[model samples]
Target: MNRTPEPMSRRPELPFHWTLVLLLALSVVLAACGASGAPSNAPAAEADQERPIKIALMAPLTGGAAAVGEPQLNFVRLAVEQFNAEHGTNIELVEGDTELDPAKATTLAQRLLADEAIYAVIGPAGSQEVAAVAPLLAAADLALVSPSATKPDLTEQGLPNVFRVVPRDDVQSATVAQFLLQRLAATRVWLIDDQSSYGVGLVDAIEAQLRAAGVAVVRESVGQDETDFSALVTRMRADQPDAVFLGTQVASQGALLARQMQEQRVQALLLGGDGLMTEDFIANAGGATEGAYVSFFAPDVTNLPSAQPVIEAYTSRHGAVGPFGPPAYTAAMVVLEAILRASAEGPLTRAAVRDAIAQTNQAESLLGIPIAFDTKGDIQNASFFLYQVQGGAFVPAR
Candidate 1:
């Protein structure tokens, strides 16, 4: 054994080239880890994620309907403020004044679409305005949540992005017809339309119902801007209809009609749609709207428990809440909630936000109504409220 010791077995060493390669790879990984520990300087990417979301409010912020449109914008602003404060969101509201013109609304819609930051639209408050912009909005996959556009065909067109908080004209028309027959016990009624899309749709539906119910009905039309309703008032006096249903969206027109009726000694009860349910109607009527009835989509927000804080805060800054304001608030709420939800799932896109809005189910809304959307983008189980102008205030009619 002591003779020549066997050569000691030994492990072979890696080749020099292979050793260098492994060392290089290890250094690269360590360098990457070291670099990752430092703060990133990619401001563009981070800023993109943190930028404020933009929402557009399309309403008649100027012209005759400014009174109605102002409140709509204000309520939506209030909603956005509250949402921002409570949930740490940043939303910038851009105003698009549709001014009761469909052409104007289309222009505004195009502008909104051009802005990549705008994810949703609050309204094109009138039905005609909604109709004008809906195709473009639908094509672009942008969500449109209207507070007051009630034309039935708007949601019936199978457009995936159109949604409204108020009941459709058909539903409202049925309610109006029933009120005429049951509440007013009117055997003969006169229906007048302002010749706008909203007015035409409402009057058409109501007239059909009236004829079917064996109620004698007279149909008439007037321009929205018509200030002289004397002829119509005289005709009503001659016809001696039990009630005069004014399907006008122009508050001033409603006031003018009521005033002329008073002057002409027309004793028929005056009734108007939601567009005339604002304080402007009563104020501009100059005591002529007394004992008159107006139907609205929601009970006065001042009367809702859920809307108290909103009403208080809004009134403190913006004066009074109108029939149009609460619905806009609810619309804003629906859009904002859907946006937040879509954001949570992943990166925000108009299509995703639209789908989220379509799936909305609010346990309760600012109007104190349970909010949910049908397949048609119309609110499910929608209804209307009738209020009588009693003692210079709107009192819910029984």
Candidate 2:
């Protein structure tokens, strides 16, 4: 048995290359395990999976001013739709009808703020409504950008979160007063108000300016919900004013007044505020609207190169030009810009977005100008234009 131990069978050893291969395999497994155990870019991933940004739009969808507010809402919708189409991001729009009522506006604003998803709110078309809802939005640290509320007191209230696209009534009334006094050389003015916030405020401002400019305020009248203006027209005629200012909404006794003035042959120059800058006024008042004057924050959309495309797109969508088109579109753009600026680094938070809006300065907008807010959150260089109703259409007068 000790016969050379049968020449112990030589065992085959693993090749050097095979040992190196095993080591490499172990290294790969260890690397993978280390990578999996480490913290990820989890915040970014979670943010990407979060819900889309939301903006709440409050307006008078069904009320006397619906004629104006509906077009404004349409413009906002069109803007958001176009923006989403190009950006590959979703913007959820929630619309609440305030019915042009202050209490209803407050209710809708509260609901919008409670959602926790809305980063910003667009509007309550009327100044009265804005006055109602601004406190709630300011309390909740939410931003509100109104398209058509032009009351000066809105920005003067020292509300940090409140903003408006339209120029204040101070601007509009001053410009219109200048046009009536300097341009038209009207010596005597007669003013009328429907007793609404907008009406009273505008008339008061205009009357003050007219009086300061040495134009005599011959007569002042207040009327509401009345189909007959015979007494008012008789008094206005007695005063023999050179011009008459109709500081009332188009849908509220304005058309009737214009019609009565024409019917009774009261030859005073008819003047109005942006509230009369609607086709409904012309449609309801008919030939009486001819030669009427109005002051509005409405920019000349056709002349604004940057806004032309937006106007065209809107017209294509609705088959007609929109009222408050430029302002409404600009409001949506401002909200969109705020959302982008806030969400650029992370998920859009309401507080961050509101801050971004408050800090916005000199942003180029669809109006082909930079939009910046002053200490009062009002556009510092805001201006208004005068228009005349010629052939039942608003044509630039100044």
The candidate maximizing TM-score is 2
- Runs in model 2 lying further than 4 Å from the true structure: 1-49, 63-65, 195-197, 225-240, 250-267, 280-286, 300-303, 345-348, 362-364, 367-369
Listed per candidate, the RMSD to the true structure in angstroms reads: 17.5, 17.0
The digit string of per-residue lDDT tens for model 1 on 55-93 reads: 889999989989779999899999999999999988878
Residue 81 of model 2: what lDDT?
A: 92
Error of 1 at 112 (Å): 3.0
Tens digits of per-residue lDDT, candidate 2, 300-371, equal 666667677877887777766655666887888888888888889666677788778777764578766678
lDDT of each: 0.87, 0.78
